[model samples]
Target chain A: MKITILGCYAATPRSFTNPTSQVLEIKNHLFLIDCGEGTQVQLRRNKIKFSKIKHIFISHLHGDHFYGLVGLVSTFRLLNRENELHIYGPKGIKEIITLQLKLANSWTNFPLIFHELTSKQPELLFEDSKLSVSTLPLKHRVYTNGFLFKEKAGDRKLLIDKAEEYNIDFSLFKSLKKGKDVVSEDGKLIPNRLVTADPPPPKSYAFCSDTVFDLELVPMIKNTTVLYHESTFLEDQRELAFPTKHSTAKEAATIAKEAGVEKLILGHYSTRYENIELFRTEASDIFQNIILADDGEEITVE
Target chain B: MKITILGCYAATPRSFTNPTSQVLEIKNHLFLIDCGEGTQVQLRRNKIKFSKIKHIFISHLHGDHFYGLVGLVSTFRLLNRENELHIYGPKGIKEIITLQLKLANSWTNFPLIFHELTSKQPELLFEDSKLSVSTLPLKHRVYTNGFLFKEKAGDRKLLIDKAEEYNIDFSLFKSLKKGKDVVSEDGKLIPNRLVTADPPPPKSYAFCSDTVFDLELVPMIKNTTVLYHESTFLEDQRELAFPTKHSTAKEAATIAKEAGVEKLILGHYSTRYENIELFRTEASDIFQNIILADDGEEITVE
Candidate 1:
């Protein structure tokens, strides 16, 4: 799995810094998350194919999070896209987008589907053969949700030498990979474990942003392969976190520690600080495995 | 008068090219015109102060022309701007912006004023002591208006030498500048014309964009100092102009020639053409004083 950070700064977009937006590539899907202002231009700069994005997940309705959505939808129409676009966002998202389209009188020729989210509970959003996605309720100034993406385990691996030593017929190889017992050519039953080994463990990633420090999220994101959490401020500005519904770097690291995530990626830094290294320095005290997200940075999950 | 081309392209914004947005600095006022996507960043790149902008004029509701308005407004709120923001656009602009703010729960601390335009005739939109703005109706796929920014004729210039020669008292200098007859110290009446000259012929700039070639604009923008007109296509692609409700370079030149404008600025060129000089070449046959607008180019009207 690969993740690209198109923008991760907080507040307004600047000449060198952008707002919050990212692309998560898992399996065969490219999911766009939290499209902020100038996101389309960021997508172009990052060289991400606009046509490949089919699903978009918005964390909230903040300008830094979802202001670019209408422009992206309009550009898709201008590009003459024919593929269906699915948008999962807050409940009022549809009205905001549709009103702009109506006023402009430029509706998309392709299917534009909107799934307005309002539930406050964890619920499955998408599931296919290889991957599944669900929502993690977040505490913020507005109604918000974080997404969890997980890869499903594949079929067991076959041991060719062991199968042949057991005199297993080649025709039963498929059945053996499916974890089933097979009758060999000699009419002797062979157990599945003897011929095949277990598949690799499934990998999962959790994305959380613009939320206050809450222990409730630890249980939902526990043991994640990678966790991306917002760290809007440092320990020096811890007093601003609760009132603004944002998290400090130490607070994010505490959540990562409690959740036991393998790697914690910190983002959504307020633009007030001149140095971003302070975030990592503060977060490392609680969680040793810390990654600071910058615009145009790409990370790979093993 | 100075005009900065923040973005002067048609259709969607690209990595290097931006959509339609510009700033006209005239008579101590910065008037933003047609805010497209990425305009706020463009403003930052141009080093223009955001606080100086008090009025924004939108030509239409097309995404490329007005998508950045909401983000700009939201940024003003984030910056804690105390000045009132006035937006002039099509009839539905208020609903579109208000809906987004409502959905995001981000109401501006400063007053947000909207002047919705629905007229097909020329109408005054703004007026001050030094300048006045009026609408120039244009033909397009949707309801559209071109803006005409005209400098109000200033108080007649007082020739200091001429006033001294006329023996006018120092206390009567203001009256002489105001073009009123003043009594000299010898009790002789001095005619205003003898002591004053016309203030540099009230420079004007007309911004016409996203519209087809319309002869009716000639009367509205007649004898303007500078004219910025949309030339979306060259003569080679002239066939696409009428159908798309856009103008060719030659057509824009024709309008400039007919309107008797001092200088013609050709912009909003379709991105399909690799060479923009071809637009100037095609237009020069009809209009000699032609300026091709590129992003970040600044023009001074004299």
Candidate 2:
């Protein structure tokens, strides 16, 4: 799985920093998250294929989180996209986008589907044979939700030499890979474990942003391969976090540590901070594995 | 008068080329015209103070023309702006903007006033002691209007030396500047022309964009100091222009020539062309004093 950071700053977009927007590519799905203003230009700067994005997940209704969504939707129509697009966001998202389209009198030719999300409980958003996605209810000034992307276990690896020694028929390979006992050509039953090895462990990524320090999120994101949490401030600004419904770097690291995730990615930095490296310095003290998300940076899930 | 090009390309915004948005600084007002998706960032890049922009003029409801407006308005609220803002655009603009703000629950601290336009005839939108703004009706795919910013005639130059020669009292200087004859200190009547000269011809700027080659616009923008016209295509692509309701370089120049504008600024070029200089080449044939509009380029009206 590969994740690209289109923008990672907090608040209004500036000349050098952008607001929150990222692309998570997992199991052939490119999911756009929190499309802030200037996201389309950032996508172009990063050379991400616009058509590949079939699903977009927005965290909240905040301007910094989802202002660019309508523009992207319009751009898709301009590009003559024919494939259906799905948007998962707060309840009012569809109304906001459709209103702009109605005013412009430029409705999309392709199917533009909206999955309005109002549930505060953790509810499944999407699921397929290879992957599943669910909401992670977050505490913010407004109704918000983070998304958890989990890859389903793949087929077991076939031990070809062991299968051959067991006299398993070639036609039985499919059964063996499915972790089922197979009958050989001679009519003898062979144990699936003797012919196949365990599959690689599945990976999951949890994205949480624009939220206050909440321990409830730790259980929902527990033991995930990667966790991207918003650290809009440092510990020095802890007082400012609660009132604004944002998290500090140390608070995000604490959540990551409690969840025991393999890697923690910190983003959604407040533009007031001159150096983002300060986030790493503050977060690393609590969480040993911390990665700073920068615009245009790509991270591969290990 | 000064005009700053925040974005000048047509269609969707890209990494290198932006859509339509510009800043017109006339008198003490900084007017934002057609805020495309990335306009706030473009404003920052150009170092234009956001607080100075009290008025915004949107030509149409097209995404490329006004998508950034909501974000800009929200940013103003975030900046704790207390000044009132006036927006002049098509009828649906107020509904479109207010709906987004309502969804986000981020009502502006400043008063956001909307002047919805539904007229095909030239209509006055704003008037002040120093300047007046009117809508220049244009032909486009949707209900559209170009903006005409005309500086009101300034006080006639006092001609201090001539006033002294006439022995005019200092208390009557204001009357002399107003082009009124005043009794001199020696009780002699002084003619206004003898003591004052006409102030530099009040400058005007007409911004016409996303319109087809319509001669109906000529009378409204006639004899403006500078005219910024959309040249979405070159003459070679003139066939595509009429169908798209966009103007070609030569077509824009034709309008400029007929209007007798002092200078013609060509913008809103289609991204299909690699070199925008070709627009100047194509337009200069029809009208001289052609200037190609580019992102971040500033032009001082002569």
Candidate 3:
């Protein structure tokens, strides 16, 4: 999976910085996450194809997270898009978008689907043959949710050298890959473990933003391949984090450490800080593998 | 009054161009008009004080006209604005803005007042001691209105030379300046014209956007000091103007000529045309004084 950071600033969008927005490409799907005010312009500047965005996931209804949604939908209509579009966001999102369309008298010609999430519990929001998505309940000032994308387990790989030495029946290879004991022509059982090796590790990615320090999420996001977490403040101002329902870099790294994630990517820096280096230096003390997410940076998870 | 153009492109926001948004500064008031996406960034780039904008006026519900409103309001709240804000827009605008704020649960401490105008006839939406604003009906695909900002007539200019020559009484000077005849203490009637001269021409600015060839507005905006009318297309694409409800350069000039405005400014150009010199030449054929409004350009109406 490849994730691209279009913007990472918190609160307001500045001339040199932008608000929250990102693009995650898993398998053949391009999922847009959060869509701040200038996301479309950032997309254009990054040379990303606009039509490739078929699904959008909004963490909450905050203007910083979803202000670009209405304009993007309208631009799709203006560009004569005919493909069906799916939007997954908090409740009341559809109403706001529809009201604008009604007043403008410019509804979309294509199918526009919306999945309003009002639940406070962790629930499965979307699933397909290749990947599955579930919500991670987050603690924030408003109704908010983080997302976890995990690849489905695939067929097991065969240890060709061992299988050949054991003279395993070639026709029974499929059954062995499915973790089934195959019967040889002589009516003897061949254990699946002797023929097939364990499947490759499934890749998983977690996205968390606009949330307070909540350790309960560690279990749900255990052993994630890559974690993108919000680091709105530093340890110096940790006192203000809980009251605002935001997280500090140290707290974000603590969560990543508890979850045992392979890599931690921190973003969503507050505009008050001139440099983001403090976030990396601070977060690195808790989690060894840490990287600062800059606008236009792309991270690939194997 | 000083007017700053933020975005003027007719279509979508691109890396090189932007959509519709402008700032009209009259005295201490910073009146924002038509806030398209990326307007906040443009405001930052131009070094305009966002805190001074206490009022926002939208011409229509088109995405290009008001998509940036939610983000701007959110930024204001994030900055902890203490002043009340007023928005004058078409009917249903309040519903959209309020719904988003409700969903986000991020209400502003300042009052957000909305003046929804649904009248087809001209109406006064805002007024103060120095200025009065009224809507000018326009033709478009959606419900639309143009804004006309006129400075209230100032105290009549005192003809100091004439007053001294005629030995006018200082106490009667106020009544004479108000265009009233005064009776002298000796029972002599003196015409007010002898003591006072007409006030400096009250400056007026008329803004018309996304409108078709509608000559009915000429009488309403007749003799305005500055008129900004949409010239979305050139003379070559005039055939497509009627269906789109947009005016060509020549048509905008014709209206400017019939209205006899002191100066005409053309903007909101379609992105299809690279060169805008054609609009100037075409408009100059009918109107001698025409200025092309580009992004960040300032127009001072005196």
Q: What would you estimate as the lDDT of candidate 2? A: 0.94
Task: Name the regions of candidate 3 deviating beyond 4 angstroms.
Answer: A154-200, B159-197
User: Can you give the lDDT of residue B190 in candidate 2?
Assistant: 88
RMSD of 3: 3.0
Indicate the residue-level lDDT of A199 in model 1: 88
Deviation in angstroms for B174 in model 3? 5.2
Two-way lDDT contest, 1 vs 3, winner? 1
For model 3 chain A, the run of ten residues with the poorest summed lDDT:
A181-190
Give the lDDT of residue A220 in candidate 2. 99
lDDT tens readout by residue for model 1, B1-302: 99999999898889999999999999999999999988999999999999999999999999999999999999999999999999999999999999889888889999999999999999999999998999999999999999999998889998999899989889998988888998999999899999999988999999999899999899999999999999999989989999989999999999999999999999999999889999999999999999999999999976
Which 10-residue span in candidate 3 chain B carries the lowest summed lDDT?
A: B160-169
Report the C-alpha lDDT of model 3 over B1-302, residue by residue, as the tens digit: 88899998896888878789999888567889889988999999989999999889999999998999888888889889999899999999888888888888888889999999899889998899989889999999988999999888888877878766666677878877788887766667878877788888778889999899999989999999889999999988988899999999999999999999989999999989898778899999999999898998898876
TM-score of 2: 0.98
Q: Write the per-residue lDDT of candidate 2 for residues A1-302, one digit (tens) a residue.
A: 99999999988999888899999999999999999998999999999999999999999999999999999999999999999999999998998999889888899999999999988999999999999999999999999999999999999999999998888888889888889998887889888888899999999999999899999999999999999999999989889999999999999999999999999999999888999999999999999899999999999975
| Candidate order, TM-score descending | 1, 2, 3
lDDT, candidates in the order shown = 0.94, 0.94, 0.89
What DockQ results for candidate 1? 0.86
Q: Can you write out model 3's per-residue Cα lDDT over A1-302, one digit (the tens) per residue?
A: 89999999898889888889999999788889999988888899988888999989999888888898898899889889999999998888889889898888999998999999989888897898889888888888888999999988888888778676667778878877888887766677778888788897888889999899999989999999999999999989989999999999999999999999999999999989999999999998899999899999999887
Which regions in candidate 1 have their CA more than 4 angstroms from the true location?
Answer: none
Residue pairs in steric clash, candidate 3? none
